[model samples]
Target: MRTAKDRLRHTILFELLGLVTVTPLAALILNKDMGRIGALAVAISLLAMATNYVFNLAFDHALVRMGRPVNVRPPWMRALHAVLFEATLMLITLPIVAWWLNMSLWQALATDVGFALFYLAYAYVYNWAYDRVFPMPSAVRIKAADR
Candidate 1:
């Protein structure tokens, strides 16, 4: 398990890095001004930050309940997590994306799917790196050892 402070740090770093990388790419790909894309990026990032914090907390708790080490998510679990995260995020962002870019729902869905795909890959890699860089305390293992 990680402390609240650690989770907060993780969320902040993830969002900041994502924004830096995604904003320019989104603008270029969409043929929009950087400011417009940047604003949208920031908005989506804010929503994601909140979701990331809550989702990860719940995910760790699920691992604990399942007798799995909180620090080590299996590949299957990681994939599921990334997929679910992106799916939910895309749903939330689709309307906002359409409004911001003045696109129809179908266009927004297409654009959102692209964003989701990028994030699906990004989330997997980012989490792998994050876990390596800031390993979580293995509460489950430690508890089992005491038994």
Candidate 2:
């Protein structure tokens, strides 16, 4: 299991990097004002950040229970992780984005789907990089194995 601080750091960095990468692209693709897109992006980022912490903790625990090493997921598992995270997040964020942007549900869903696809790729790469950079401490891994 990761410490609260580690989780916090992961969430913060994930959102910060995502916001930087996605904001301008979303603005350009969506053809909306940057400020409007930025605000929506920030709202989505904040929600995703909170959801990420909780979801990752649960995911890690599930992996440990299943006798998988949390830090060394298989590629298939990594794909599942990204898809599951975005699927859940899209559910929570779609309505919020529609309300904030005053768009119809269909429009919101389309927009959210676009974000989801980007995040699916982003999450896969980000987690792969993050694991390499900040591996699970050996002590934590050993303890998880003991379970």
lDDT of 1 by residue, 1-147 (tens): 888999999899999999999999999999999999999999999999998899888887777777677777888889999998888888888999999999999999999999888988899999899999999775645456433
Model 2 Cα lDDT, one tens digit per residue, 1-147: 678998899889999999999999998997899999999889889999999998998998888788776666789999999999999999999889899878999999999998899899999999889888988765445454457
lDDT of 1: 0.88
Give the distance in Å from residue 106's predicted Cα in candidate 2 to where it truly belongs.
1.2
Misplaced by over 4 Å in model 2 are 139-147
Task: Name the regions of candidate 1 deviating beyond 4 angstroms.
Answer: 141-147
Q: List the residue pairs that clash in candidate 2.
A: none
For candidate 2, the 10 contiguous residues with the lowest summed lDDT are 137-146
Give each prediction's root-mean-square deviation over alpha carbons: 3.0, 2.2
What would the TM-score be for candidate 2 when compared with the true structure?
0.91
